[model samples]
Target: MSARFAFNHATAKFWDQREAVEACARAGAGIGLWREPVQEMGVAATAKLVRDAGVAVTSLCRAGFFTDPTPAALEDNRRAIDEAAAVGAPVLVLVSGGIPDGGTIDSARDGVRQALAELAPYARERGVTLAIEPLHPMFASDRCVVTTLNEALDLAAPFAPEAVGVVVDTYHVWWDPQVWQGIARAGREGRIASFQFADWVTPLPAGVLTGRGQLGDGCVDFKRYLAEVDATGFTGPIEVELFNDALWARPGAEVFAETKAAFERVTA
Candidate 1:
């Protein structure tokens, strides 16, 4: 089907910043970058480097932590939009942060709505899209409260196309019974801003958040994910974003090579 592919920087920390982008360029792949690493290299310099290396940036890692609903947090997201624009990335992934003190999930969701109200228009004006990424329900308590594609779409519906959307990460939504339906709806509504893949596993060690499995190393069906996303007419890059500690400890080149091969194998 000629699907495009990309890699997230977290999968290969063993390679220095430049080599990671260079490797992706060499592989003829696109990239999704985390804010910290990019900030370290200086956003302008990082943009120049990626451009010089001829790599397409699929999306910026994240922006929103709106569960707090504070002015400072909202302002930070605004700056994130600026950074995404500066780097020529079309989408800024937003992870709706966890519940605020004494607030319920319902209240936290309201925070997302409020934050989006303020930030979506700003993002639209800047020519950047905000992609609300539904984190795993496992993270519902601390990391992010939005834990399903359906929920993400519900949040996105109130905003314009250029202003708000959803990031469908397999690691987070694989267990969702309504995932296929959700993907169909996302496609029908034209709101699929990003597509990411990672595997699921048992015996989750400490820091479960960092234990994302490499493609094909766990129980997700990539063929199904690919088919569904393609069915939506969403032609964006499929990004591989693993957070495995084992992977981070390996040589970056080795992780990249293995991940690329695994991606090809499963999608093949």
Candidate 2:
């Protein structure tokens, strides 16, 4: 078993949270938690569940949407930071929201910067790193505006590395020609708050958000990614986050077994 393997809750979106944590515990794998379920189960209960199971909480997904940066938005992010802290998750993934009705992409990017400035200090105080996740460019208009690892790193640059960092998710960064360089740079700057795995497959399903390919099922070179990230001296959990509708429709235990096997195969 790979000591670094972790299963992201989104990989089995509809699975029961307790069952997921239990599965991770049995496998000696860490777990990435989602906010909705955590809130559903109550933060304290979820914390106790994982603690009793001895399952590591690798990272929390998600708490960004900072393009607008209203007071309400910033408040929500702070709550997210607290949740991450309570769950013992060191990082909280952030997805910059799309451009507002009157804002341009540049302005939206600025909003992200401003929001980080306001949130980084709070996050640092809580011992949580706010990780900026750059979604693919296609999502810029409606999902996320930060579209590359370099851009995410730049957004994180103004803050202390521990307070703000970038998430290197393969589904979003694999298309970048300079991805390897960005990975190396992230390592050098110690800004890699989280490292995630997902593959790219052709003929993407409608609404590409759920089209993430399983490990070894697409074009991404996992071995190379693992080698590069490992060379950076990042010995943290390696989370596999898939958003495939097909997988979500299956029994979560079955999907977990298959995905774990795929991870071992690809990383082997």
Best by lDDT: 2
Clashing pairs in 1: none
Give lDDT tens digits, candidate 2, residues 132-236.
Answer: 999999999988999999988988999999999999999999999989999999999999989899999988889599999999889999999999998998999
Error of 2 at 38 (Å): 0.3
Measured on C-alpha atoms, candidate 1 has an lDDT of: 0.90
- Kindly report the root-mean-square deviation of model 1 from the true structure over all alpha carbons: 1.2
**Local accuracy by lDDT, each model:** 0.90, 0.95
Per-residue lDDT, model 1, residue 180, is 98
Work out how many backbone clashes candidate 1 has: 0
Per-model TM against the reference: 0.97, 0.99
lDDT of 1 by residue, 60-160 (tens): 98888898789899988998999999888999999999988899988998998999999989999999999999988989988899999999999999898
lDDT of 2: 0.95
